[model samples]
Structure formats: structure tokens, C-alpha cells
Target chain A: MAEKLLEIKGLKTWFKTDDGVVRAVDGVDLHIDRGETLGVVGESGCGKTVTARSVLKLIDMPPGRFEAGEILWKGRDLIPVPAQEMDKIRAREIAIIFQEPMTSLNPVYTVGDQIAEVLRQHDKLSRKQAIAGAVEMLRLVNIPNPGKRVHDYPHQFSGGMRQRVMIAMAMSCKPQLLIADEPTTALDVTIQAQILELMQEMKDKLGMSIMLITHAMGVVAETCQRVVVMYAGKVVEEAPVEALFGNPRHPYTQGLIRSIPRVDRAAAQKERLEAIPGSVPSLLNPPVGCRFAARCKFAMDVCVKAMPPLKEVGPGHRVACVL
Target chain B: MSEPLLSVRNLKKHFAVSGGVFAREVDRVHAVDGVSFDIGKGETLGLVGESGCGKSTTGRCILRLIEPSSGEVWFQGADVTRLGPDAMRALRRDMQIIFQDPYASLNPRLTVGAIVGEALQIHGLAKSRKALEERVLELLETVGLQADHMGRFPHEFSGGQRQRIGIARALAVDPKLVICDEPVSALDVSIQAQVINLLEDLQEKFGLTYLFIAHDLSVVEHISTRIAVMYLGRVVEIAGSRDLYDTPLHPYSEALLSAVPIPDPTVKRKRIMLQGDVPNPIRPPSGCHFHTRCPIAKPDCSQRSPELVEKRPGHWVACHYRG
Candidate 1:
């Protein structure tokens, strides 16, 4: 119904490792609508980051390859796009922010210089105008006394402030889509709240779609309108945020939701959290059929015998598990 | 608290920052300033705060891993801070720690068995090689690792598996009080649950006391019988887990609780977000350290610090207002 901004269909990005092929992003299908926040959630090795990185063509060519599937941006497939063309597409049409703000930023450069560089390259603005625009961007991100703070180096800012500067740089080009990969993972709970709030404000102000890649279920529940649960390089479940949390279809999804201990429930006697048994199967030479079958309590003989296709289970809800 | 198993009084750890040509002490980061608490026998006291709040520092001070600038650490009726080298070494047998990053904490050169058994050898808990091997295998199995994993290196295991190894090593000492410093923070959601359950099981089985330090409120609440909220190296509030969540007496605690991203989307929340990042610890706020960001801060809040007072039965808060 709503206009699609970014659509990833059955995309498989694998890395050629010595141990074997690492099926990082195998058979993943997900999409982001205009002005919507789509949360991609999974554990550390679930390929959520790889999928996000693949969209920007950021992976190393020698070791990584898009073995199968299509990435559609505004009805145009991006897999065939030239390297040089992708450079233009990046930061201008779609920008990204990484988890570690301390490393991603250039410590030597001033905050203003970093932000202005993005504007000058993409917007092609004059040096004076770009510097002025940088201050304005800093103010937009709620950095106090932007005019003075903009001239400060990355080290001058705290972890939370550095993340704000990163956001300002990413939004400088006014990209249609913004991809944040664990942007608040390194931050404290209070600071995380500030950053998440700033992101929502920025998104609403710019009318841009955000692909928030995070492992925190609470973060997804608060910020995302829709969610895609990834497991072992596959989209285990996809649904609206309400549907995903209210009635999780996939066993993996249910396990993840239940894994989070609740404060309200903590009033009662401490109960053992229903933790999912077993670790994620190795991405290298992944198991045949459903990757989650080994850990799934409801897994049947048929589940391990044949790969289950992602099927629509309910209205606007899709699941990869046969059950 | 009936002679708590461990009691800390006026604990303070200040890290000096050097600068200029001669590297003079420019300033000091008041990491843990005047923090006091007691952990009863077999009780879990969850220490919670933001990144710079010094929860980890407090834990380390208790174990003498990081020497405190000033404090009295009384464990098992003896002052740990005043103990001699041999006495402290002996005390270490009752106070073991599990670090946050499992990858860095475990020795890479040592095999799993060697690493877990090292504690046994140091404490002289095992009589012979045969007994040591038997104990190591039992500890490994208790933490849900296979006997075959004993020969493998730290790199051979995943994050979850590595964490289990770290836990096994901690338990090898048979410590009466285990300081878990963000033990589950590095693991995935599902694995985090598994580890939490394991810790609880081990706690009950061995009658172990824990000082759980983490940034996540929900996890702390779920695991802890009592929770202490810290801000700017000071304990702002301490209460029963349910009381702290249900009726936070301090403004900082209220804001901190509200900031936690609730996993249920259906539960609409009103987040009381504080402005600006955590102030520099080297030059923390003069009075109430949180007054700068406190929404209800008064003139007196900036001029004088508020003493933590019991606002309700078993609930302590340090705010000038609220209760």
C-alpha cells in the first residue's frame, strides 16, 4: 500500500573464508516503506549487519559476494550498479552510522569540518556556506552551543555527543533512507534514550525511512513500526511491530521476545528466563534445511529434511518456519 | 541487614589525568565517590548506572582488583582494604570476578581445561592431576559445555561458549561472593538468558552471593533481589527491585527507569528524558551530581548535596524532592 523505499528480496551475501563459505546473508527478504522505521533484529552473528552493509556495497569484493537475489531501491535493482555509481548513491541517497562513534569519526578533524565535508561533496555548497550549514546541523541534533562545539574535535565530545555528530553528518546529505547499525549499543541507557529520541525527531523532520539494525528487542518495540527477525542469515519472521511482539510466529522470534526479562514482572518471585537452548549454528557450512531446526523445540523431522520457504501466515505477517 | 556478608563504606576511587610537558596531575575522575552498600549473605545486589557511573569500579574495589583511593571494604568480618599481601591473596579465594568481555578475559594461549583449572591449582583445591581434570570437566559440564571443548582454545568457541568458560573459571575457585561485571552483556539475547539461568542455578546450588553490575535495568531487576541506582559515581537510590521500579523515589531513578526501552509496544510509555550527556567526572557537579540534569532541581540542589534517606520502608533515595 505505502510506497516502498528499499526492498531486499531473497538476497544472499556470502564470504569466501578458509574454513568454508560464510553464508552471512542467505535468502533474506525485507523492505522499508517511505517515512517508516524498520527494525532488523538478531543476535551478533545473525547477518543483520552484513545485510545493511551489502545495501551500500561496502563489503570487500575479494572475500564477499552477492551470490543471489535483488536489492531494489525505488523500483531499481542495485546489484548491477557500477562501483563509481554506488559511491554517488552512498551518503547522498542512503547514509549509514556505525555502532562505535569513537572509531568511525576522524579524531583529528573538528566536528564542523567532518560535517561540512559531507555537504561540500554531496550538496556541492561553498566552503563558507557549508561551514555555516554544519553549525546549523549540530544545533538540529541538540548539541549545546553548536557554533562553539562545531569547532571542537571528536575527542572533545563524549560518547553520546560523538554519536550526535555522526548523525548530523549522515543526515547532512538529506538521504531518503538512513541505516543505523547498533548506533546506541555503545551508549548508556540514559544516553541511548537521548540518541533514539534524536533519531526519531530527525526522521520525522526529514520524512525519511530508517533501517535500524539492532539486537535490542526493547529498542525495536519502541522505535520500529515494522520488524524483520533474522536468524542464521535468514529472515525467520517479518511483521508489523505490534504483530511481531503480540503474536510471534517463528520459534526463534518467540524465544528472543521471552529472553528479555521484564521489570514489571520482576515484582513477582524471580523465575528462570525461558532461554532458548543451544547456540546459533556456524555460518560456515551451515546446516541443511532450516538453520534453526537444531534449537527449535517444536522442530519436526520435516523441518530438518527440507528448507522451509517464507510463507504468509497472517495479514501482513510472514514466517519461514513450517510450524 | 543482620551483619551483611560484605559491607562497603565511603568507597572512593579517583583516577588522575596527567597533562603538560611534565605530565602533572591536571585533574581527577571521581569514578566512585562515597558509595556505601551492603550485600547480605546469599543475596544478589544489582549495581546499576550509566557508563561513567563507576559500577564496575565499585565491584573491582571490593575484590581489590583495582585499589580504592579511600574506603573500608569489609568481607567476612575482615577489612579487605587493610589486609596484608598474604591475607588478601587468601581473601581472593572467596571473592572471584567474571569480566564483561569474555574474549579478552580468557587467556588465549591456554586450553579451556588449563584456564579453568588454574584457579584450583592456585588455591590448592585439587590434590592430584586426576582430581583437577575431574573437577575441571565437572565445572565445564555445569556451565553447559562439552568435555571435548576442554582441549580447544578460547578462539575456537563462540561468544556464548567463551562466556561459559569464563563462568566455569570463576566457579573453579569456589568463591563465596562472585562479582559478575556485565557477564551477560556480551552474549546474544537467547544466550544471555541461558547464562542468567545458569548463574541463578549456581547461586542456589552453592549458596553464593553476587554483586551484579550492569547497565541494563531489566536484566538487573530480574536477577537482583535489591537494586541500587547510581549517577555520577554516587548511589542515588537503593530499594527492593519491585519498589525501585514501581515507585522510584529519586528523579534520576525515575528518569532512568522511564528511559529503558519497554519491550511491549502495546504499553505506551512516557519517557522522562534528561537533557545533555553525563557531565565530565573530572569536574562533576558541585552539589547533587545529577542536579545539572535533574528536572526538579532547585537552587539548593546546586548548592548542597542531598544525603540518601529512607523515603519508604527499605527504599533509599538521595533527591531533595519527590518523597
Candidate 2:
């Protein structure tokens, strides 16, 4: 059996807004195998980003709080770790890249300096050695003329190149796991393809596990080995990528798969897209039972009375619906 | 047969790039470089490209939102480019646009009722105060918004609700041709389906024509009868959506279609990724704009430009090779 890389059990993350407590991530559980890619699929405010953030302790603590959960990394609990220890784990074991490279990167600093800083802080390398390491990292990401381009500022690089620099900095410390939150959402299709290909190459070379958070199902189908579907701050379905697309059991998951029109399919044959009615449930006052019951076509009285538990419907495929 | 509803001939929009101490115009960014297309009555034409490919610019030019450097825009057998301000304002009543970001596009201070009814007031569609309020209520209901949402501010609504309000406002003036610029790109997956269905329903009810401009090929393919692929500042190929996706003609179109990540994990695509970034529009590749990054470029590709020509009956391609 493959070694378990990370395991999240019954995680509940909440935020105290002026209106009420926003249950951003409620009772979510997932696991990733060693050297495998796990795709977290959800729309805006579905708690996918918050769930990834909680794994790294990246959520702001003033209003954000972890209610109950266990984030087990190689059988060790990460939720209660001290900040000092967590910092080391963040730099050496897991690194994250964000969607908007322009806002994430500091405009004042040169790309080389930013990358070198990561190496110096994590590995405690000398300044001269760290500079050389930054150049090598840039080259690994396939940036042309890395030596000269390394000194350029963030504004000097284009959107795609800036994202490559972000990838280089994230991989500088040789982390065991990488969390990419909408890493290619803001990129052009061509640039997105290049970045995804580069990440695939780097993953094979380094033998690291990846947690890809995105709303695009196409991306998940192309890159992920396993998939987790979230709706209204809860996990609705989890399965292997092929099984999820081939035979989606959950109603919400089925709706999402049907909604995305395929470029390879003829649209005229279908009268219109199969759309789920209504909108996502509000986090402040989420529905009493199934969060998707308001928009689901297969809702029942039982679904409105109690929240469903994740049960294995097939081998390695789980769904959280009563039906 | 009758003439097409909209015919754009040789449309070009060049933005001047300024530099140095004096900020003098040193060069021009050829945004929409001499593009032409025709859309029949009640047909949806999709303009697709990466960022900076000028798809949005072409949409804006037809509405006269941005003045084109040189072009002939014939709408309903009238030359829109030659119209005076008063005549242009009248033409605008029959043409409307939906922006990408609903949060930024809407007025924060105004109530939903006023936002949607403002267009009716401008065009003097309402006959009386009570009639105007009734019309606003009717428009809200048409867009799937409840009557209670009239007094709510923009911030009080969700992203999907805000977009419905935008659609209602566009429909208030009874426009014949609507330009949807990435309407669902900012929406969640399920919410995107709802909005798309709403657009389709409204179109059927009103017998409307649409110019759908988007980067996602799947969404574009779903809504468009015909698709035009753009690169840099020129259209490389145009054909029926199914034909274009099944067997693309131009090299650039083939690369673009192959880059779309499909939603099925079992299907492996033969991705033909172009090398290098899109060249700067101020000084695009001397002849063929995509030559710098074309995977199968010939020596003559850099010496002469290819004219857009019909290869198959209804398919058009601008390339020296393949087509």
C-alpha cells in the first residue's frame, strides 16, 4: 500500500463575522497518498481555500478559529503545534503558491533576492551560495537567460514569467508537499498549459505530493489522481478521478460535471446546459441538513432533517448524501 | 438571403504607448488589428483568445465604447462609425454590454431598483413614476430576482445576484444585440450554469443576438454557433464551433484547442504547446504575428503576412501552412 502523505479528519474552521459565525470549513475529511496529486474542487466561498490554509496554519486567527479537527502529517498532529515549530514545518515540509502572482510578490524586491531569501531562511545557506541557488531554481523552471533575468523586478517580468518565478521560490527549499491555490486561474490558456506541464515535470523529478485547489473540473480531470468535491463548507463527494467523472454518485457532483460544456462535444444537439437551480447556501445560516438541498433536484425530507455521513459507496469512492 | 445583422469590416484599434520624461507617444499597441466578421440575426458569435488578444477590444469597438482607429461597423444597414454623438447615443439604445466583474461594474451607492431602472429613465422608456417602478419590478422578476431585492445595495447581494442585476439593466433598454464579455468567468461553477441558462432563456424570449467574448473554450463552445480564434491582435481562424473543435485549420487554432483541459480523465489530449510568450503588440513579429511562437513555422512565415481566406466551405483560416 502507498504511504499516507497527509490525513485531515473532521476539520471544522469558522470565522466570526459581524453577522454571525461563518462556517467556512465544516466537517471535512480527505487524504493524500505519497507522490500523488489531490484535487480540491469547489466554487467561490466553498471553503476549499480555507481548508488548504488550515493545513498550513495560514488562516488569520483574530476572527478565524479551528473548532475541531485533526490535521495529521505522517501520523503527527499539526493543529496544536507551536508557532515556532510550525514555521520550520512550513518552510521545509510544505510550501504554497497563490493565484495572483502580481499581488503575492513584492514589487520593490528583485526576483533573485526574493528566491534567495527563501533559501537563506529555510536552509540557512550563505548569501553568495543562496544567490547561485536562486539562479539554478530559475533555470529549473525553464526561464530563459536566468542569470540576467534574475535581477529584474517583478514588474519587468510578464504574467506567465512572474508565475514561474513564484514556482521557483516555492520549490527552492525542496519541500515534501506543495499547495497550489488557483495557481493558473489568472493565466492565459497557453501560459497555463506551460505552467501545468512544468509542475508535472517538477513533481516527477522531486517525488513530492501536490494539493491542487481549483474550480475548473477540466484541470482536475487532466492532472489529479484523486478528487474531493465541496459544497457550502462541507465535503459532498470524494473519489478517484476516473470514477468521479465516469460515475459521479453525489447529486452536487453530478450537476457540476454536467454543467461544464465540452469543447469536443456538439452543443447544438443539447437544448441547453443542465443547470442546478438556486444559489449556494449562505455560510452564516447554512441549511439544517444537506447544504445543497436548496438547489438539488433529488432532495428528500430525510435530506432536510439530518446531515449525511461520508460512506463508501464503492471501492475508494465516498459520498455524503442520504440517497 | 437578407444581409447579416452585424458586419464589421477592417476594424482596428491602436493604443499609443508613451515613454521617457515627456511621456510622448513612442509607439502603438495594435490591439484589434484589421479584424472582420459577420453575425446573422439571432445568432451567437464567440470571440475567443488569451489575454491581450483583443477579443474584448473587438466587442467594445462595435458598441462604440472605444473609438476604433479605422473600421466600418454596419448594424441594421446603417454605418455606425459615421454617426454623430446624437445618432450614436440613439444607436446605443439598441446595443448593450455586460462587463466581466459584477462587483466593480455596478454602482455601490444605488439600490438594485435604481440600477436596473436607470437605463429606462435615460432612454425615457417609462411613461410615469408608478409605471417606472412597475417596469423595474417586472425586470427584476425576469432576471430571477425577487421583488424584495429592489431596496438592497450591491454589497448586500451575492456575486450571482449582482450579475443578474447587471443583466436586468442591460435588458431594460430592449437592446437587440448584447455583448457578454466573460460574463460567467467570475462566477462559481454551479452559479455559472444558472447565469448561462438565464441568458439563454432571456435570449429565446426576446429573440436577441449575442457577441460572446470569453477565454474559456468550453463556455464559449456551449453558447456560440460559430467561433473565431484570435492571437496577439489578429483572428487566425473562424468556423462552426463543432467543426473548429473537431479539426482546427490554423496552427495557432490547433494549439489553442489542444490546450483546453477536458473534463474526462480517461481521454488524453495531444497537446501542441507553443514555445515562448506572445510577442509585444507594439512590435509584433514582422509579418505573421504568431511566427515567434509558432511550433511549425516556415522561413517565409516571417517575411509575409497571410490573408484570412476560406479553406473549407464555412471555415476561414489565416495561415501559410496546414490550411
Docking quality category of candidate 1 according to DockQ thresholds: high
Tens-digit lDDT string for candidate 1 (A244-267): 999999999999999889875644
> How high is the lDDT of residue A80 in model 1?
99
The per-model lDDT (C-alpha) reads 0.93, 0.91
- lDDT tens per residue, model 2, A68-165: 99999999999999999998998889989999999999999999999999998887789889999999999999999999998999999999999999
Q: Which residue pairs does candidate 1 place in steric collision?
A: none
- Residue B119, model 2, lDDT: 89
> Model 2 Cα displacement at B245 (Å)?
1.0
**Model 1 lDDT at residue A300:** 92
- Per-residue lDDT of B54-157 in model 2, one digit per residue for the tens? 99999999998999999999998898889999999888889999999999999999999999999889889999989999999999999999999999999999
What is candidate 2's TM-score against the reference?
0.98
